[model samples]
Target: MKPTLNEQLRQNIRFTYNEALELIVAMGMAACGEQMYAMAQDYKIEMDPMADSFYEDTKARLSPHTFRELQFFFGHNFLHKTLDFGFYVSICSNPEPQSADDWIRSLEAVPAEWMLTEMVFGVYHDKLEELLQGRDWEASKGNLSLLAALVRDTPPHQEVIHTQEPLLECLAHPEECKLRYMQLLSQFYKDVFIRWKEPLKERSEQASAHYETLFAAKPEQFIREIHKNEPEIFISFPAAFHVSQASQVGNHFLNFTTAAGNVGWVIFGIHNERVFGPAADREQTELFLKAFSDKRRLDFVLLLKERPHYGQEIASALGITPAAVNYHSNFLFFLDLISVKREDHRMYYHLNVERLRELLALTAKVMLD
Candidate 1:
């Protein structure tokens, strides 16, 4: 018999203080952390000043060419498909220590086809096999039109188009891309992350121990708390859950990927949000109201009421840019009134209608009584 989600989680989930893997993610973020903060500021969200200083120092450590290469490879938002490669490396190097040299060697051993597929389409899926059955990676390397065709089939397509240039560049010169990646990792790790290695390792261990205690006591609740934005996955376990070092100060970075097997893998973030599943309190109610009070955000929810929309579509409808939509969406996400879905290798924003109705009833009761 197949195991239940809880059993699978208990059996498959592995948490550790992998310095090498964390460095991969940290370097990727360092590549684009300043840009991320600027985008946040555009939406009126203030980030930690120390994170700003950290990113500035990281930028100073890189040569001009290397810095551009890092941004080109990772993208400005650090959401490039290739970033998933770090997690893939961790998955392979588990139960054994991983080193920086091991990371580059792993990249050398990976097939060009595997790297290209992951880059073109954010994550690999069997359906992609059917889509590109006859076309080989070498042939598709410089084919911009092929990317358009694939993106068209995927819902919420515009965002994927934003990544086409970097994806194509990586495909065209896979070896150069690997070399640049290796250089960025080696240089950044040596200059910036080496001192950080031990401190981050200690934090990861402490966080892992804390989460393990909560998870062993109440598995579902623990998952819900960590995934405050999308609470349903606890009911159906994903590929695996990983705990890693914090990339930015004060804000935990969470990334979800579907690796080679079509199973979901999530790099769980630090637990920082207030628990949302328990009975709603006065503070929670006020938080919900503050979220809805924004006219644009209210409009966003109303648009979702008509049907789920992706970031690009929502931005277009609201006369705002995609970055603005992202900021407003973050608030809606934390409130649990919306959840994210991945379909056809792209992301779509979904409304939790039941959660919305629950809030309405609660608000009405409070006002009338």
Candidate 2:
């Protein structure tokens, strides 16, 4: 039997640790393409068009300069989004490009479309700028505000605006600004769909297939069996479950719990799961309850420390049912381990790290001894 995704991921974790895993989770397919590109670039490998259709397709829509900028932006976003996982882990674990020249050479080696989005915004950008040049600065700003708002609420407006300030400055008429913004936004959607629709569909299908196989396996049973046979493989936690490689069943190779008590399986060779010490025995369970009143509450604190996640994000990370995340997060707030900030209607939970560490240390000292 092939090692499941979880098994592959567990091995990856052991070798590469958590940063690589987080990169995979947060960046998904994009990060994979980047690593491949970096490796090829460093080794002076030629880029293969067939394998890199995504990057190529995205490049076709832009000028050479803009395309280079886009790559930089994408790469920067990739690193920024993954910063919490730590820098050293990212550098040492993956195959990365050694220099700028290497990156350019690597780009030559990979299939373009595989690494880049299909949508080309260059043509539309020129047209949109031409339209905006006749307008006043205030009108342009208003136009941009309207477009930004529409992008979030309306699915049709998906233009990758390179510089919002420039676009805003070019608009002439206050009333006409809305109309032009709508036109630009609509064109963006149309262009994206036309250029990359098939690839996007394929990507979606691949993701669905990957997850379907991942969620289908019996995660708990796999974890328990691994714990029984390869005891050393499992990482123990005082109040949480162990982390270990599951049987090479299906597409999952490793399993671990979220700070919120949800069990998740990662794809093969993506090691992102944090190992807590061990599952709580009855006595330990009782002690865990006494220390924190609820394990979920403690899990909430962990989630905040792990990332700057909102409720939905926390819920997804923890693999807990949505209702449970909200419920436990409320409890955590009440306990003063976390604070909820309201932006619009969405609430973001930030961890009180000092408080959390103090509590975690106190609890660990009591439980371990």
Candidate 3:
């Protein structure tokens, strides 16, 4: 079928998050998932008491199965992108499947990969070398048995596959274990989801209702007004992501969609709000003043007032890196002091004169009152 994402400009947009899957995935990735770690590398969460407590408690509750083999198996691994992994898209629907059966069926249907890609890194990297050394068929029984269970029909002798990061001794029988491993993960996900189902369901319902209402009324404008810099239609519906900057976004993803006909993405974000507070209280005049007290941000804002400029252009003019420009602009963007425009791949940042005026008025009102 055609993507049809651009056709219904309004109904396709949606917001979604799988609390259970996300939590498990977070823990799994924390062990060795590169992408997950990168997103969480920033922010000194250890300094935040609540964040610290949550982290420790969650860690303590983890079982060996949940923390090790299972984590590695279910989490992203050597064959992450290569296989039709069921868990990644398991909860991508409305009124998420209410029974474990849905997951079972999904796992059973996972497409197989012909080869078990080599694992480059992990706790077990090269651990197989010792087992494979000077071993006859009978002596390799332990290794063969495990491989036999994972892969169908084993030969008299098998060779291990090498990988970039030592993640795997060989890509043998990886896809064979898809169903059994999935069954295990399925139970874990269901139990945890049920235990917290009440709160998770309630949050989901309220959020769904809120989005339905918002999208029902001028859905196109909602996308354009809030995310002018994004595409009219996302290639993937209901996308998700995580962030270490809890103070910046709280416990919510920056969610929005175009064409309400169907959801294009659900950005499941790890807001990490369990750890901290907001950037600043708008009611606090000193906070507002302090926010703009940064000379670099102030200069960036002034430049936007003249004309729209992208991060790179702004960075070039300031004799700094583009990343520096993004860092400074993010502050102004969060406070609504600026607006963004997208033309193809390039993002143009513009100063919001009206927003500045409102803040100025609010500042005056606060001072006089």
- Among these predictions, the greatest TM-score belongs to 1
Ranking by TM-score: 1, 3, 2
lDDT of candidate 3 over 1-369, digit per residue (tens): 664444454444444444544443433433333433343453322333433433354345556665554444534441231121234333333234224345455546544331122121122223434433443433433353343333332211122222222223234444545544565565555544344445444544554555455445655544433333343544444433222211222232223333443322233222323222112223334545766888888788788889999878899887889888878776776566887899779999988899888667767755673
Using lDDT as the measure, the top candidate is 1
TM-score of candidate 3 relative to the true fold: 0.43
Q: What's the TM-score of each model vs. the native?
A: 0.60, 0.24, 0.43
Please provide, for model 1 over 3-31, each residue's C-alpha lDDT reduced to its tens digit, 9 standing for 90 to 100.
Answer: 76556556645455555566666666676
Clashes in predicted model 3: 34
Please, what's the RMSD in Å of model 2? 20.1
lDDT of 2 by residue, 1-369 (tens): 887645543443221112223222322223235665664453334344433564445445544544343333233322222111222222222332122223223334333221111111211323444434454433543243444332233222134343233223322232343333233323323433245434443443443343334323533334443222232233331111211111011122233344444232323311111111133233333443554677666666666787667778878777788798877765555435678788768888888878766556646655684
Q: How close is candidate 2 to the true structure, as a TM-score?
A: 0.24
> Candidate 1 versus the native: TM-score?
0.60
Q: Write the number of the candidate with greater lDDT, choosing between 1 and 3.
A: 1
Query: CA lDDT of each candidate?
Result: 0.60, 0.37, 0.45
Provide backbone clash counts, one per model: 0, 46, 34
